[model samples]
Target: MEYTFDQAAALLNMGRNTLIRRLREEGMLGTDNLPTSRWRGRGVFRVITKMYRHPVAGYIHYGRTVITVKGLNAVSRKLRLAQHQPEGSRNRASWVN
Candidate 1:
């Protein structure tokens, strides 16, 4: 399905400009400002075919290490885990302090 800038931004949880930047940086989108047979309106709309890279970590599975693009869901999940678990607070208390 085709998505406008605002819709895409909301879906991706990113600023519209950031999405545009990615489209440009990655060369995943075009800026002809002209509509094609498939797309309507000017080039303001971007056509997303496939996710070349993950929205967040940008790294696919690599030897048990899931490196993702910054600001992606994976990073957010990790941050949440860290926040909940401070340090050395296992389920069972071991020996001395």
Candidate 2:
């Protein structure tokens, strides 16, 4: 599911240059062949995969936004537990019941 600069820009609904600039600033792209200014030529860029750890979750980028696998798992476990709880059980509150 790797995406090129053009694909990523289109998917994010952002200009190609803007996406490139963000990736460059984030150190996810090499700066060697970049234009001196935004008004210059389209800079050569590549997506660099990275892993980020938040206080309560871990995330990975697949080009557009960070996906929090750990957070999803935690939420899924909670949902499953709620689904299995018996009706009128103390564990099943009004909000989750």
Instruction: Write model 2 residue lDDT over 5-74, tens digit each, in one string.
Output: 4654554566667756765564434464232354233222222455676667657444333212222222
What would the TM-scores of all predictions be?
Answer: 0.32, 0.32
RMSD of each: 17.5, 18.3
User: Model 1, 1-97: lDDT tens per residue?
Assistant: 3345555455557786775566444443446422234423333243333334678889454211111222223222422322122135446343112
For model 2, what is the alpha-carbon lDDT of residue 57? Answer: 66
Off by over 4 Å in 1: 31-97
lDDT of 1 at 67: 16
The clash numbers for all candidates, in the given order, read 6, 0
The candidate that wins on lDDT is 2
